[model samples]
Each structure stands twice: as C-alpha cells, then as structure tokens.
Target: MFTGLSAFPLTPVSGNAGIDEKAYGRLVHRLATTSVDSIGALGSTGSYAYLTREERARVARLAVEHADGVPVIVGIGALRTRHVLEAAEDAQNAGAAGVLLAPVSYQPLTDDDVFGLFEEVSAHLSVPLVIYDNPGTTHFTFTDELYTRLAHLPNVASVKIPGVPADPEAARARIEHLRRLLPATVTIGVSGDATAAKGLNAGCDAWYSVIGGTFPEPALALTRAAQAGQPERAERDSQRLQPLWDLFAQHGGSLRVVAAAAAHLGLTTPRNLPLPLRGLGAKEHAQVAAVIEKLQLHA
Candidate 1:
C-alpha cells in the first residue's frame, strides 16, 4: 500500500528542446537517497500537460531506472481517455509501481464522465491506480460518493485529496468523514504542503508532497513528526517552511517555486522550463534563495 510521503519531482526541461534527462535522474537519485515513501514523476509539478506522450514515457523510464529500489508512480492524466490509457500502458511497461490520474478535461466533467474515464483506464491497467483529486488543477471535484465509488474499483489503491480545509476543526471533521466513506484499502493521501500538518493530524494516511519532491529531507522530517503524533513538532517544521510556502503562494505555486528552489539549491540548471511557462525572474529567485537560507536547507 502507498503510505507516507510520496514525492512528486519536477520534469526538467531544456528550453523547448525536451526533457532534461540527466537532471531528472539526479532528482530521482536525491529522493531515493532520502528514502521517501515513493517517487511520482510527470505529476502536475512535472508539468505533464505541457509534455508530449513520448516525453512523459521517457521520464517514467528514467525515473524508474534512477529510483534504485524505490517504487515509482507516474502520472498518466490527459484530456482524452485513450491518451491516458496509452500513458498507463507506457508506465506499466516502464516498470512503474502505479499510475496517478486526474480527470483533466477542457469542458466541465460530470461525475459519470469522471467515473467512466477511470473505469476505462483502470480496465486497461494491471498495476495499481491512484486517483488524484486535485480539483484546483483539474477543475473537477469528486464528491464523497464518487470517491467511494472509485475506491471500490479494481486495482484502485489510493486517492490524493488536495488538502484539508484551512480551518482546523473542519479539516479534522472532513478527514473523519472521508475515512468513514472510503474503504480501509483505499489510503487517503494529502497534497498541498501548506496545510499538510493539519491534514496529517486529522488522520491522512500519506502525503503527496510537492516541496518534499524537490527537497525531501525537511519535508520528510515534517512527515516523521506527523506520523509520530508529534503535532507540535510537525507544526514547527511546517512553520519553518512557511517562508518558502509564502513565496510559492506569491508566485505561480509549486510548479514555479519548485523549479526556482531546485535551481537555487544547484540541483539543476537555471531556466529549465517548458515554453508558455518560463523560470522565475531575478527578484523571485532572490526571494526563494532568501527563504532557503533562512531555513538553512543544505541542498
């Protein structure tokens, strides 16, 4: 079962040329060395939507290869169901442990549409399927009923919820309700590092972390505190990351912040982003650097 911090690494791009395989492999090595629960490539942070199917497959292959003994989960979401299925097949062939999927659509998708999409994709996959409920990106929210339905599907292993509510009480209550609704087999994973402490305290089984994917040590530290039921320690660790999270909020979020942070830490080359989306400016880079310095993060 997928549990603990599942790091989602960014896919390094060499301008418009294509994926920077060398840098991407370095990221996988870093995460594997940190011993994160798992590594997810081609996630939203990886900019899966911007890459071609072939590029994504290459990423999955490289991630699986460089991950050493670590399990790899590749994101296979696309607007078209056939494209998603093809990506799933590619991930499975690449020896990935599972595939993460979100119901990405140009038009608003109904519950039936989302359900049918997963049904079709799951029918074709032999590996585990993780339902990525990132409404912020997909613009398609899954109700409790729909999540429950998806949980019962064959090969459906877990679901990644966006995060808990900001309100502490509401967040706990929401997680409790979800626990009641979802089967024991379907692990409830939380995303969005901002509210991660609250989400984990509320009983989330795993953390699908963005920042952890970029720099797993601190995030892994926070996850250990949370898992140990040390709320005060977890909150302190989360607060320590607030400055960096603040930069993410001010800028374009994890996609941009992670790229900037990775560059600042010398993990990859600067300006390694796809077209239509550029790297952070000098001022923004300064902000991320300041936060990293303040946090005392050593790569």
Candidate 2:
C-alpha cells in the first residue's frame, strides 16, 4: 500500500448535496481497473480537510468497496487528536489497509505537540500508518529528527515527503539523506506530481500522486519505468505531460485543475468541489480539455 503509485482521488461533492457517492465511486473504481498500486482516499488531493467526519468515513467505505482488492489508505487528519483518532477508527473499521495522518492545526505546532499526537494515535492503530508531511497545507515543517522519532513508532510504514530538489544530484542527495535518518523498514514516498519521476529515479520508493487518481495510465507508465530502473523512459513520459503540470501551476493548484479535468471527462459534475472552493472557469476548462485531447489521456 505504501509503495508504488498510490493515487489520491477527489471526494466529489456537489453543493449542499454532500458527497456524490456515484461519482466518487466511479473515480475509485476507474483507478482499480488500472495498474495503480493503491488507492488513497481523503488525502490532501481528496479535500480531506473540507469534509465532515461522517462524510469522510462514508468516503472511506466507498473507496474500499470499489477498490477491487487494491489496498486503500484513508486519511485521518484533524485539528484535534481525539478527532483524528475517531477518524482513524472509522477508517480502520471501514477496512482501510492503512491510514494516512497529517499534523493539521489552527495554531502553530511545536515539535513536541506533533510528536505527542503521533505517539498517542500510533499506539491505538491496528493498521499501518503513513506519516503525511505536507507542510503546504499543515504549515508544519518536519525536521529529520522528527521523522526519526515518528519512524520508530509501531505502525509507521512510510513517510510521504514533499517534493525533492529539481537537479538530479540534489534530489538524489536529499532522498539519500532521508534514507540514512529513517529506519530501513519505513519507505520514502514523494508528493509533488511534477517531480515524481525525478524523485523515483533518485531512489524514492513510491509516489503519492494527485494526477494518478484522475489519469492512472500515464502516472503508472512513469512509475513503472522508474521502478524498472529505466530513468530515461520515466523522464520522457513525465516530459510528455508537461502541459497538464503547467495547468496545475497556472490554475492555483491541482485540486481546481483536476476537478475541472474530471468534469471535462464526464467522470463528475462541474463545480464538484465543496463550498467556498470553485472549479476552473470556462477559459481554464478549455485549456485543460485541449491538453487532455492532445495528450490522448482519454482513459
């Protein structure tokens, strides 16, 4: 579940209608039919922070039900430790193979505060846990010392680090440094879709991808090529999808752009994001459509 391409799908929510179960299920089922290694439900890409506990739990069940034997990793992050534990329990009861936890808080967290949360939660979890270190959303940067402490916890299976350096040597060194600090059992997975191939080629064990959820084939191609030790092939595959990555940069972030792509593909309705968050406009959607058509990402 921790290794390879773990695709995070959006939790398609229609305004006031709550979760669009059919569309969310469609997204998970689509990935299950492909070669993705695992399904990541309710991660940052899935808008886990925006949904209620009940909605998140239902989404977890739906993902597991439609995954077709692929392992499901459910995100269980919240502002409070108690709430995080509740979410974790719900995910485990729903048959998630593992749970992903990010240290989210309204106020800035000290290293001890973050460590204590993991210590308490890790002690109670039955399934494996992935340490989600997404500083962009959480605003909490993780030092190597913190990672070492968390990696030693009983169910700490992997650490999902942020993007690596763009230069090949720098990326390799960054991954290598983390490898030395973390225990041998814990794998290092990389986020930042654009740098996924570079991370993998540099020795990261997996990719926690956003685009892989919506378009599995291309992500799988790049992942497989990297895992097979064909770095050049992986790099070439990533280069081909530069347009889509560019759209992610231009359209704020991946959530809006991917929601737009999903809508454009008819996998979900337009404006599928939760309230206060809008999908791409007509001009942006047209641009995304053109890129999809040109890339032949019809899958």
Candidate 3:
C-alpha cells in the first residue's frame, strides 16, 4: 500500500470534558473524505495517556466507525508491557486494524527494556504492531541499534519516528539503513506533513500524522507529490503550512495541539484539555484563530 497521510485525530471532549462521540464522528467524517490512507485514534494526538480504559476503547470504536473503510490504528501505549498487551487485545476486540505503541513511560528505560517490551507485546498480539517514537517526551530515543532489534520482531509492522527535522536527509539515510533490519513486509513511517516530505521521499512507507488530523487534504496532497518526486510542489504546500507548524513548535511536545487544530477548523465541539496540561489560553486561542482564518482553513 502507498504510504500517505494517516490522520491521527484527537478524541473529542464533551461539555464536562467527557468523551464526545458526536464531535469525534464529525471530525472523522471530514478526514475520511480526504485522501488519508488511515486514521489513528487514542494515539498521542488523541491524548490516550489521559483517558481511562473505557474511554480509549470508546474512541477506538468511534474512529473505526466514522472512518468507514480507512484502517484505524489505536494507540495502546502504557507504562507496562502487560498493560500495552491488554490494551492491544482490547483494541483488536474493539475492531481496530492495528495497534500503535509508544515505548514505556514516566521513567527513562534502557535499550534492553525496549527490546523486552516490544518482544513481549509483539508475542501476545496477532495484529500488526507499530512503534511510536516521541523522544521529545520519552527523553529516550530508539537508537539505530534498538530499532534494529525491534525491527526483527515478528509482529512489528512499522515504526513511527517523529521530529527528526534537524537533519532530515541524514535521518532518511539512517532510516534507510535501519529498514534493512526489518522484514520486507514491514514499512517505515514518519510523522507526515509538509516539512516531513523530505524524509518521506528518502524512504518512508507511511506517515502517521498529527497535522493530517485537521488538514488531511493538503497534507495528503503534499505527501502524494513527494512520493511522486514532485519536490517543488511538495515544498510549496509545506511552506503553506508553516503557520500551523509554528503553533505546535510553541507547544513543545504537547499533544493538546491536535485539539487546538480541530478547534481551528470548527470540527470539534467545545473541548478542554484534561488535568495537568492546559489548552491554549484565551489570548493564545484568539491568535491561533487569526492564523487559521488567514490560512482560510475550514471555519
């Protein structure tokens, strides 16, 4: 399958900050109409860490239901391997196409911990497995060696490597070498977007994206262009998305930024960030609104 934009949407929050199926379905519908190859719910973009088990499963079902045909990759990240295994089973029961796992949590883990974690989870699961790399928070990266190890695991289907823009060309070369470690059936992934096209062109099989959560059309268009070797066109669209990038850059790894984008397009209901991490304040929201308007996105 062609690796294209995979919009990892935020789970909607209702009036009391509960899971909002209505809002989530609406957002999913909008994305489903785009060229997104897949949809991910309860992933980092969906604030999976903040949700209860029931809420995560509910969002997983909602995402698949609304996607209609687009595969739903549910986020099954947790602090323990057993919990992740259980969540993966839950996602499978909930009809998710696959499971996306972020390595460990809270405390930093050694490379051996990562190997054992993936090995354990992959052993228990029947579905395709995806590795989520969010070094901005994990503070621990999947080293070339670590990834090499996980890539050999049976159920490992893909790797989601994000924020390597510092030297994307070099990252691509590195990923290409790493791809050698994985099975041929396994495809590599990047957190797709305009700026991400470089790595995609270099060798990504897919893009698991937060930006695609709101701008699937534009983002997918760019990814398609890049895949076709149309670097000039892809660069143009990536440049067009700079403002949105600026917003997330300011947040510095806050997954809440996905919700902010949803609000920007008026696709989500009145949503608030759960405890600990606050959403953009009043003035910030207004400024974000101004930028979204200038870009002429939905809403």
The segments of candidate 2 whose C-alpha lies over 4 angstroms from its true place after superposition are none
Please rank every candidate by lDDT, starting with the best. Answer: 2, 1, 3
Query: Please, what is the whole-model Cα lDDT of each candidate in the order they appear?
Result: 0.90, 0.94, 0.76
Q: Write the per-residue lDDT of candidate 1 for residues 197-283, one digit (tens) a residue.
A: 888988898999998888899889999999998988988999888888788788857788889888888887897789888878899
Candidate with maximal lDDT: 2
Clashing pairs in 3: none
lDDT tens digits by residue: candidate 2, 1-299: 78899999988998667999999999999999996999999998899999999999999999999999999999999999999999999999999999999999999999999999999999999999999999988999999999999999999999999989999999999999999999999999999999999999999999999999999999999999999999999999999999988998887679888988899899999879988887777998899999999999985
**Stronger candidate by TM-score (2 vs 3):** 2
In Å, residue 56's CA in model 2 sits off its true spot by 0.8
Residue ranges of candidate 3 with Cα displaced over 4 Å: 14-16, 165-172, 192-194
lDDT of 3 by residue, 1-299 (tens): 22577787777765346877788898787788885888888877687887877888788878878887888888898888877877888899988888888875788799998888888988988788888887765677877778778888987888887744546678677677867776787787877353476667667778778777876777788788978888778767878878877877776653656666677667875464566666777787776787778777763
| Candidate 3 lDDT | 0.76
User: Against the correct fold, how does model 3 do in TM-score?
Assistant: 0.92
